[model samples]
Target chain A: MGKNKKENRRNFLSMLGTAALGGAILSPVLSKAANTALSSNVTEIKNFEGRIEDFLGGDYTNIKLRMQDDVRRAMKKPAKERKWAMAIDLRKCVGCNACTVACISENALPPGIVYRPVIKDEIGTYPNVSKRNTPKPCMHCENPPCTDVCPVGATFKREDGIVVVDYEACIGCRYCMTACPYEHRMFDFGEHYSDGLPAVAAYDERPSFEYEKEWTRENKHDSPIGNVRKCTFCAHRLEEGLLPECVTTCIGGANYFGDLNDPDSVIAKVVSKLNVSVLKEEFGTEPKVFYIT
Target chain B: MKKIFYILWAVAFILGIIGVGMRLMYGHEPAAYGSRVVWGLWVAMYIYFIGLSAGAFLLSSLVYVFNIKIFEKVGKLALITALVTLICALLSIWFDLGHMWRAYEVITRPNLPSSMMAWMIWLYSAYFILLIFETLYAFRIDSGKYSGEELNRLKKRLKILASIGIPLAIAFHGGVGALFGVVSANPMWHSALTPIFFLVGAVASGSALFTAIFAFFWKNKDSEYFNQMIQILAKIVLVSVLFDLLLEWAELSIALWMGTPAHTAGYRAMLFGDYWYVFWIFHLLLGVIIPVWLLATKGKKPIAIGWASLLVALTFLGVRLNIVIPGLINPRVPGEALAYIHPRLSFHYFPSLMEWLVALFIFALGIGLFFIGNKIFKLTEDTENKAL
Candidate 1:
């Protein structure tokens, strides 16, 4: 009885070995089939790179090239000497929300936290109505109200005129939010879009490069999750000699970014226009962002 | 009545534990205050309790600083209440912070020149230290362990502390108002009168709380001094309420009458918006008129005085809510609220259930602390009491 049992066990082991070899041989074939199916869709979108023109199908304006040139010129000077500025032409803004989406993608903003939005206003009656779109980003004011109200000295205005918040130092009092006239600040509530789902997806756990630092939301109770957030003018991208994501993604070619200290820059000429204005001018925030009608 | 009080306390304590647990686990995920209406019930409760602390401390000053003979008996009680309420106030604001763990950064790296909040933190720290020493001295003298020259020396020390505390209370409480007043971004809170108004409101609410505690909790309430004390406190609260009302009217009439959109928008929202009852009913009617009438018609009666004081103290939260919310609801740029659409991105706000539960927990904790202190210290004026 023991000899028969040993012989049956050896036969089962041999069968298992044969099945493992067959499965290994078939796995590559199955993967090849899957790869072919996915490659067709991948080829169609391979060149898109998340640009607005990829979806809108418009001629390339080369605005990104000019902005990149401006960024390169600004990088040569001392950080304090080169003042970063942005200009938005309301006439050219189609309000396609490309800049808003681009900013979210660049910053990897969590749910309910937005750094930029295109405010739409309807003018006149229904029959004669015309809609006006204004894309709003952080004003990066020379005298930012948000910076002055931070109790912990977490948020401060740099000599280069950018308002930056030190996530490590911020106590998340939200006092800065109350003090901001623009209402541009947003608090992170540590929410996940993947909540209540069967499983959390990889995208939900992805890390972002903000302030040129790789930050992963490994836990709910962490910095930037409890901290207030606003636009940093793609400062991380700027450090790498790349234009802001919004400036490149603007489908209407409305947004311009450059060094305000450089007279030859496109943003400098755009900001000099007589029609240029700013939101809540009475606040004396002296916003670095200019809007042209 | 005693059984009912115990039952309520137990319920509140349990619910408070759950609320605190949720806060620890979630971290403001349950709160309704968004970026638009950034300051909500917690902020209101913070100012409300801080105002009570300032008010109670100042009323005690009448006995210690000004040598008012009438308030002498409840001097220790008033100080203890102020200390307890200040703790409650600090906890409320502490929980409201997003990074509560990093709250120490305010003391370590204060931006004094540009931030009124930083100034408030530093001033309150000084006030807190002063309060501890003053409370200790009150107990030390009442111990009756030292007689003659030593007692006189203790009294003199207490007087010096109280004298210093008068300005400290004013500076910190007025600094709280200045914290809001300096925000020129919100026209509703930007007036120069904001700090003065906050000081008066604090006094009114604080004195009312003191009067109620004396009438309801004093073991020897049948004493002749109790009746006179109640009447005096009732009169003081009445005058304070009237002055606060005058300030409210001045602010409302100036903004409403001007009809300028920039200034009037927030005022209009307060008086006529969806939460209009918060101002008209809770604050104006219940907080002001009912108490004023009760205090005026039956000022001599202890029960009437107690009820009026209690009503005023409880409903003053509505007054605080009005001050915080209206200032934040109006957007600086027109149509700013429409720029984004999210649950928390709007200009409208009311506290969530979690907020109320957490507030209730703080209230229960404060009551427990006060009761424990009373048991240990015997805060009554009776000479035969055990020494602290």
Candidate 2:
């Protein structure tokens, strides 16, 4: 056993040396390859389909184009027939918060309202420490506790499995906020970045077209202000044949969004894998969002 | 002393008017409650006042339904107290709403199956109407205008109304408890014990308030009848306090006995956090211990019993604050508190000055309503000489 351990240590050290030498030799050639690929931009779907083998063989695959394809494919089906889902790859996330920023801008979120937040966890003690970034958004659960607690019928799950809040009907009692285990919902306290300033800017006045309705934040007591706000999976954008802002803005290409009902769709393809885990599955919320470690 | 009380009420009323104006004009912008701690002092006060209302209403039923003659004189006062406190409770919750005007939607287009709040609203409405009619029948029986047969019929009507009110009060207040209890996310409140605790708390605090009023306001203070009433009420309040304490112990010890971090985080915060004094000093000491001591040591003394009951009634707000705040102080996600820094996203919370001012206004409004009710209607047995 002692001899085997010594031999194993030597083999590991040699493997490390070989890997380092290979990395040094390949770095320049990989850069040159990337440069050439960037220069020869073949950005058409039909041409891309014809050159699918070449694209597959290439080191860099454009995820945005792939996501656009996924969105288009899912849009062809009826809303009820398409079950929307999100799958997040934990390994790829750098916690740059681009997805969070994109969600805020898309939703016109106020200072207190955050529809998506990346939670950072530092695991293990100093010498063995490694960090994990988990971006949380509204899970749009099948058995949503938030919907059942709404005093008014202001929030409900749709046929296509997205939980939505009707700002006009919501009493702003915020019972739903307490009911949500994930704490994904936030109350818009009718505050703006330009609040308490001498003159509020026009950007603050711009209407956010949530649920395909024009919600202009004209005053404090208006709908969406003093109401529970949450991520809608960018439903308005989805209806307009666009991917959710978070999916498109993720720099690491960690987030996948598509019809879970379509087995051929990107999200549907990865979600059923053994590695995928849903947050608080023991609570039986049946969350549509899955995380892969 | 009476002049000083009036002066305090006047000052509170004026400041309260300003607070109401601020609330109406600015909405929840002036409050400290954020998205993280969604409920605040107003929610606490709302439950506090509602508990008092339900307690008082139930006590009145004890006389009319159970025919507890010792509490007969205060029965009418209890009903009136219920009405006044119910109004205060409604107003307290109304101001807490993000959109106060849209509150009517709760009744007009309520989602019955999904929400306990919808049921609470409907039940409160039914209870409100029943209370008004029951109090009126109570007044009619006391008016002495009817003959022997008519008076008996009026008494029968009052008993029937009280019988209906017993279940209605239980359902309405239990619905309030279920409103918080059904929240599976909040481990502190999600228990089979929540509704039972609320019911017991309502009785303890309600009877305490009724006892104080009897001790201070009853005309024949030196009469044997008065002492008998105070003794009985003191006993009721004492038993209730003990029972409520038992429920509280079960809630605390069960969560804390094993010391599971997830289950005990809220309780630990309540017992050891920055506002630990709220649970230990305010709720346990002033609300429970001191009152329990006074009731025990000086059970027969009207003055001591009155002071004990008064302290219990006033300090029960601390118990309410503990309930509303602790359940929400702990973040759901580990690093969610630090994920984004915003006042609304904050885990730590205390009511803003504006919130207190509004609460003062609500209490002053209740007093004013009670005084007006007393003057307009023969709400008390002694006030039979007044024109109805």
Candidate 3:
């Protein structure tokens, strides 16, 4: 339990400078990433958890984790509705590019790379067909090819059906990029945000999954660069009680995010009822992103 | 003539040095062949030099190991040439490693399945040691004419050790071929037969080395003995290239028949994909089949043999490129476009001025030092006392 608390403290520390998260977030995060966080010894757990609890003083602090009731509600939603999924309704998309802009601002990504883009394709050969714009983001595959060839397990498939990269464990070989047929992976190669590259280059300095913005700012050295990158399904927001920025700003609701496992979930209903499919199913990557045919 | 020759040599040296230096300092752009093409030009060069070095070393061994007097005339030159090319081969790999500083860690923290990585460290060290011993032994055997019992015993012992070195030399280089062949990830190269292919190519290239350099040296010598050496070398070249082609055809034939997705795609790529032109025209016609025919039929004609030798040398360079580049271009899975482009000199690569200067300085610097080293040791093969 203490091991989890330490991670929560670390996660909590990354959140210090952000505006207050209001209420309803603390109990469960402490239960999840921190419960098994301690070294095995009972004495060790007592000392460490006591040290952290003392550091936090009394309870009633606001963290950016999900409220317990929210998680339970999400779980209770029928299998079709509760599990997460994303739909890019190409028909409804106007190509306004707001989703692309929102993903960039939210990720605080470096220049020369972007998490999403509207790729324009033309169908007709000789004045017959029309032009269509499609947005490209990470597929967050069920059998994510990037996770398959990661030699050191740095890029992994999480319990929530998302593939995430543990940047610290990354060896910087960039073998994952070659494995990905989608060409989603990018190498950082010492990139930075303009002249202030080194000054604010640390991941801890950016918005992270933590309790307060100030603590996160002070402890921003935890996430490193000179590694591979990709869209993370906005996992940090998934932890907070908000929908991903792209999904919220998608004006057309051309994009949807909900549990695929839950039958009553919006994602499940659309996938089962609508004639939807995924890109490159022939490659057997089992991409999580659903597209209405 | 000496001044003109030095100028030409200097120009080549400068180009290589500048190419090397540019890669080190500028830290290479992503599109400069992309990280996927890491084994491109430099790796091709490395294998090329290694083949040359092994060829020269093995040729020199024939005289010492078998006590062949007819081949003794160029023994010292052969040994030194081997050493130079070995160093050149190492420089190719050094330039290739992206984490060049951590190169030593590959040895210290070894991943044993990475056969190329392991063999690289081992054979380089072994080849260096063998060259030193062989050079000193060559000098000592020559001294036996002046001295008495001590020198003759030393010559006998050195010959015995050199005989053992013959097989080790073969293994050292053949193991290098195994490095690429064993990688299942690369369908174009993966095969149990690759090591044998490498061995035969080494011999073919090695024989051609004798023919080319021998012709250069023969210009200043009496023609009788020179012609004799050329005859023997031509035979070696003819047989080796023929055998190598047979083996390659077998591998390709098997790959064609397998019809598995990866194997068939790789075969199609070599025979008909983008790589088809280079494979059919540049490497096969120029590198193997045509030169084998030329060497077999016209070897005694010095001009023919000379042209054939140079063609063979250039062809082997093409072969090295094909081996590394084609394998990388194999699509990772079925129906996907290959991620890597075949490495070329002109793409995003201009051997930066420094890269040219530094690689030139390295090669020329090594060659110049080697020349001085021979002069210091007086490494002549005139050991009449150790009679043929």
Candidate number with the higher lDDT (2 or 3): 2
Better candidate by DockQ, 1 or 3: 1
Per-residue alpha-carbon lDDT of candidate 3 for residues A1-293, written as tens digits (9 for 90 to 100): 87765555445433321212422265345433343443332233242222322332234442112122233456554433444567777755656678877886787654444556666666667434344656767788777756655444567777677677766555444546545655556554333454344466565245443111211323212233345667777767666646677887775557766666755445555567666777768767778888764
Q: What is the C-alpha lDDT profile of model 2 across B1-388, one tens digit per residue?
A: 9899999999999999898999888888889999999999999999998999999999988789998766676677899999999999999999999889999999888988779999999999999999999988887776678757777788888888899999999999999888888888988888888988898999998889878877876777777777787898899999999999999999999989986687898899999998999888888998899999999998879999999999999988888888899999999879999888888899999998889999999989998887787656644434442111
For model 3, the stretches where C-alpha displacement exceeds 4 angstroms are A1-293, B64-69, B113-116, B143-168, B256-281, B330-388
Count of backbone collisions within predicted model 3: 60
- What DockQ was computed for model 2? 0.69
Candidate 1 wrong stretches, greater than 4 Å: A1-61, B384-388
Listed models, DockQ each: 0.54, 0.69, 0.05
Model 3 iRMS: 7.6
Query: Over the stretch B139-241, how does candidate 3's per-residue lDDT look in tens digits?
Result: 6676555357777677777787677678877887887787666555556666888887777777778678667766654544455766777778777777777
Choose the strongest candidate by TM-score: 2
Candidate 1 C-alpha lDDT tens digits along B46-69:
999999999999998988889877
TM-score of 2: 0.90
Could you give the C-alpha RMSD of every candidate to the true structure, in order shown?
15.4, 6.1, 14.7
TM-score of chain B of each: 0.97, 0.96, 0.85
Candidate 2: clashing pairs of residues = none
